[model samples]
Target chain A: MTGWLGSLRERAARITPGTLLVRGAAFVFAAGALLVAFPGEILLWPGAAVALVACGAAPALAPRTRLTTMVLFLAVGGWIVATTTYAEPVTWARLATLACLLYLVHTTAALAAVVPYDTVVAPAVLVRWLARTAVVLALTVGFAVASVVGVRVVSGQAYLVAAVAGVLLVAALAGLLTLSRRS
Target chain B: MADGSLGGAGDEDGWVPTRAFGRAILVVGVLVLLAALTGRYDLVVLAAPFALGTALSLRRRPAALPAPELSTMDARIVEGDDFAVRVSVANPDPVALDLVLVRLWLPRWVRVRDADHPYAAPVAAGSVAEIDLSGTALRWGRHDVGPLSLHGVACDGLLVSLRVECEPLPIKAYPATDPFRADEAMPRAAGLVGQHHSRKPGEGGELAGVREFSPGDRLRRIDWRVTLRTRRVHVVSTLSDRDAEVVLLLDVLHEAGESGGTGGAASVLDTTVRAAAGIAEHYLHRGDRVAMLEYGFRARRLRPATGRRQYLTVLEWLLDAKPAGGADQPSTGAFGAHLLSANALVIVLTPLLDQRSAAMVAGLARSGRFVVAVDTLPPSLRPPTDGAWGPLADRVWRMSRENVIGLLREHGVPVVGWAGAGSLDHVLRDVTRLASAPKVGRR
Candidate 1:
């Protein structure tokens, strides 16, 4: 498992600086388009943009950039959950959710294209990209849905959902680690 | 020669902390102050110190480092053997460096097995650090060993270190050849001269035939006393002296084993080297003066001599020879000059990969010198294509070999296809038989 992780890190290092800039630009453009489409919705516009930029640009940057992007993505997700609990259905919220979904697909494709495959291929690379995209998508949808239902789920339920998601993701990673070791 | 200068003639000595830890503390303190002032608490807490540490780790100043000088300890090394390369780093600064990182880049053919120091260490001022590196010679030829890079840092991670560029060193790896075994028997030509005694009679020295004395015959060769016993006037005919010179021509243009085989130990070049070594050693043992010429990137010659030492020298030369690139092919005039007066039995060991080499060999054979070509091509490395270009190229090569053989045969030269496996003796015998036959007219 450590070997797989190390290989993944090496592949990340090999990505050229130019490729990172181009992918980042594309993600920023998509985020800008999302913000323009959903004008007044405070939660939808900024949150979707941040999530999209993070997902697209994470693979291209150095270790520092990847960590920063992930942190920004988590912060934006937390803000969306906090803000949407008291708000009613807005067209902009629905549009923002749709925009986030589309951005996720675009970012995944962009990241996959730049991943260096010359050396050893590891499962962690695919798993990490998929897990990140899935988590962001799930959070965006859950918060948007909570906003729509007109029933404010307690902060305790939100924490419970987050805990379960974290455990499942860990289990999946552990399973992958064990499978890789056996092979 | 100024005060406060780093390494000039006139400077006062002072205790300066060159530790990386001290530098890191300074950077952390700056970051704490910046965080306190900016109120960007999250970024100041998360990024500042890590950023500082990374910058410190990769920091290098151009002027503060010592330049490294590289010299070849041993230029030529034999394949499968260990050899040393030395590099000297001189520190001109008055203040000592805490840690120094020396990174040496090696060529593709050379593999580093061991070194004196594998990691960074401290070096004092006005001192030189001489590093001795040892590695196995993985391939033959002239290889560049290093442009040794030096990275020095203080013990405290506050400031960026030093970076210096060093000169490159050349290492030549020679080919390895063993002594020839006497048990291996090769066919001996009749009436051939110098040291080996032959049973057949010839025109000088040994009495070969008894015939009636001709009018112009030397009186000393006449049997004058035979007249007294009613014998006819007779004369003694002696065998003529014949000295055969053997020239071993090695084809070093290209090596054969690029294509991976299912399972095999030796490549085509290995087989060729062994065969050439065997033949050259055999000739040298027989009191025959033997010379060697290598045809690769450039042509090299070792003049013919008969002795154990001469044979060893030739073997050593062969081991170190490398294949030259296609651009290095000699001019027509140079090729002509090299082969013009070569009267010895020229034994060419080659894989016959290109047309230029084949043409040159054919040209030499056509010039009436005794030529024997030992083709080193294995069947496995041939391209597996059925198209016109592929088949045509293969056929062209095959035809070139055949044409060379035919040309040599027309000039009474021998051509042997030594595939380096199975029965080499049989191949030699067959080639010898063909060589001995009357010359065939060229088509």
Candidate 2:
């Protein structure tokens, strides 16, 4: 049993360091951003800030510490979202800020996963990352604005279209994760 | 492991996903579903950026392999000269590669001037991106520059192509030495044709003497001034200028002391090779046939030849010398008197560490060939240890070496320590004088 556990640990370690932590941090930061974006959620601002900071600082810590911090911050974010009521209406500005913050969280993790602490980030790599980030941010903000306007304009059917879009998004995310794992 | 594997010259394929895309997709998908279920539209807006990024990345296929070619400015460089190596990457497709990383493997003796190796650049489709690496040649001998390594990524940073390695390029660096010209006369002029004044009287430019015209003498050879004064015709006799054969016997039996490269004190082998090059350059410059015999290892021989190009051949062979099997035992049977032309000058370059070489050289001198043993022992060699006994032992070894040198001198083989230009001047004159004296035939 101990040998089996050791082998399992070895296999987990073989996965790129900080990959899981970064992924988990992305989820937590997005959740925290959602809580902060909702109306009357001023108290959850600290949680969102804490999640962002943890993800940004995750690259410098040991794998175990990063893993623990990511899990704990994610649980805190889940708690913040669960306690808040679902009746709060969303605004365009709040939704845009949430999209930007979520993008930042994802980017922090993605950048940390590729580069190790000892490595010097080449200027070419940095420029490429920044360019890609800009494109992704532009696309996400455009879609987010369209979705918000669609919800306000077509109140009844907006939920049905969102459910279908949500299902498609889940499938895309699952496929992407599988593809990344295979690579 | 990454660096070590990259050191090999060749192409390899590898792929790594930008976790940013995966993380964004996964995080946004879950958040979008939660928002849709709870009738919250703001979550859809938050997921849009990641969703768009993933869609864009997955929509386009990865760019085709960017084949790169590596070339150096010069294939050969002299010591202390700069060499430029250029790596050019070509994009085969219409799309552009955002960032590419290139690493070059460098040998120990080469130093880059700009330290611009491991460069990164963006290459457009159908366009070539180039990186120039300039370095200096720090030491002599052939050195290999690289097997170029390349890493390329696409615009989205989602896909990384394989690490491509190219073959290592070779740079031949020739040993630089001071200019050497021998002013001393050759002991004997053996060739029937070419330069250098021979003692024997024959048809030539330099007047040896004027004598009463003989029956066979050409009328044009008559010295007009001397013939007018004598009334009877007097003919001018000149010393014939002919080429001489020079055989350089390089002793490679033993190599002592450390070879501190070109910057520090030279080892025994370094001294031997350099001195041989200098002497060969001098003789070949004088239009004399020069050959080389590397002894004290497996015997390597070069046939006697005279020309400007022959010097390069001699140097190339000399640079390949290494301390190998013993050349002292005379087991090869190739180092006979026949190898040396009649009256050819035999120069034996040895460290004099092997006592048997001394006897071998003396035998050549006794056979009527002019032999000169050049001592190539480094002058600045230190003792084996720093203790008192080390100095004493060194002195004792020196005294014994002198004794061995004395024995060679007794047999009429003049042993001279190489110290640049005029080192062979005195001994060459002595050998010339000895060659002129009347000799008794071997009984």
Candidate 3:
């Protein structure tokens, strides 16, 4: 009993205020992305959103696992299914917001995995991480907007362009992986 | 150190890709393929950040591993004194490290505040990040500060370097000497010159007697008052102020009770060591030669010397006085001759836990040594109280130990329980008187 209590106390000491904030941000972003995907449904009442919210909140429990990736993909898959099946209007602003939220979830969860619970993290580390994340989000939005405007300029068959764009994107991803392996 | 569990080092030397990197590629590929087949162009917005972020982060992989340096104060420090262990992790690569994780390992005797947990910090390119862990050492001994483990996480946790280990630093924590003062003369003065006064009449500060003027007696020593009173030429005589040799005999045959360190409850070894240090410091400061000897299997000894340097050496010797099995009578008797001087005062610090310690004390006294047996067992220590006869057993043990102490004292060895300052004064006074008395010569 004493050993158990001591281990508990040891684990408790490892939780710092900074760790709490990062984990809290991970949970909020995950739950928020899922909620935004399913509009007009109560957070607790909807079966699909609640289940996806649980998956999103997995990072709060164990951020270092592949669970965070699973949650992000599940929420995106849910969003894609809801939009296409129900014929909801796909606004670029909504897409961008969802994109930022999903990215934020990934960024925060990744930070949580590396930083120990009891770490005396320097303020500059978090500030710099947030700054980098902001830069990435802004640049992503710029490239996204440019792609959208460029696609609008093309007249005629949208599905044909989508097929070509998707193939190119897949090829680019495969190339990135290959290059990363070499580096 | 990089454990094999961390996949050791790859062809990149230190860098290992993280789960986030693989997740990014997989998620981006799946989303774009699904969007292309489903004819939904807006899905590209969701996939854009993952692709862009991974691409930008991977643009720079650290070419060199982080360097971790651990440093501590190497000089000897007293127990319970606050000390700091400095740890610095330097990033030599051009890429800024997103996070650096550091873990510290310390000996059981050391208590570094908040160092029980790992630390994380950021080091910019070609810069160093430092963490100072400060705390008190709780006991006396040679201890290691840390074998600090360090690793760097860069590219937003997409990659990590293999652990960089810094070797542990040896720190000698000397026992904290208690305030001990003995307001009595040493029983014997065996050395040529120092603080304690000797019996023989000589040129010194302590007056021995007033006698009639004799040949070779300097006029400066002439006592006018004594000459006038006696109506004869008289001179003041003084005892020679010679140093004494104090041999601290630590009985390391048995160690009893728990060592709670410094301010906590002391065990037999703790009491013995602290008392020995205090006693040595007191006599050494007063210009007396101090020596040390262990009675266990090792039977280590330090020669008698008077100085600040000997005091430090004595503390160093005390750290190695761990308990071992008993030395046979013949071995103990053989060492008794060389390790002891004719007029040296022997202070034996023992727990008196068994017959061997009591026999050793008796043997020293029988050998005509002016031996003082200091009972070093903590007063609060008690036997196990778990079974039906626990209290009874404890009572019997106490009675037995008291009997041994009684026997030792009856054999002319002064057995006294160690209390700080002035604890040995009465016994020392009696021993000094005994030394001044006449004794029969052994043929």
Task: Choose the strongest candidate by TM-score.
Answer: 3
DockQ each: 0.02, 0.22, 0.53
Residue pairs in steric clash, candidate 3?
Answer: none
Between candidates 1 and 2, the one scoring higher on lDDT is 2
lDDT tens per residue, model 1, A84-151: 55343334354345435333423432332322222121233334445544554555454445433422
Cand. 2 TM to true fold: 0.76
Per-model tally of clashing residue pairs: 22, 6, 0
Q: For model 3, how does the per-residue alpha-carbon lDDT over B1-443 read when each residue is reduced to its tens digit?
A: 11112333343567876667677777788888777877766666678788878877877778788999887764478999988788888898888899789988989999999888788889989998888888788999888888888888888887877778888877889999977999798887876677877767787899898899999999999999989988999999998888888999998888888999988999898999999999999999998888898887777889998899999899999888787764443374545745689788999999898697788789888888999999998899977799999999888888888888888889888988999999999999989988889987699
Error of 1 at B14 (Å): 20
With candidate 2 superimposed using the best TM-score fit, by how many Å does residue B394's alpha carbon deviate from the native? 2.5
Q: What is the lDDT of residue A139 in candidate 3?
A: 74
The DockQ-based CAPRI class assigned to model 1 is incorrect
Candidate 2's residue-wise lDDT over B46-146, tens digit each? 56666766666555434467777878878777666788978788877576775566767788777775343355567776789887778887766777877
B384: Cα error in model 3, Å: 0.6
DockQ score for model 3: 0.53
RMSD of each: 17.0, 8.0, 3.0
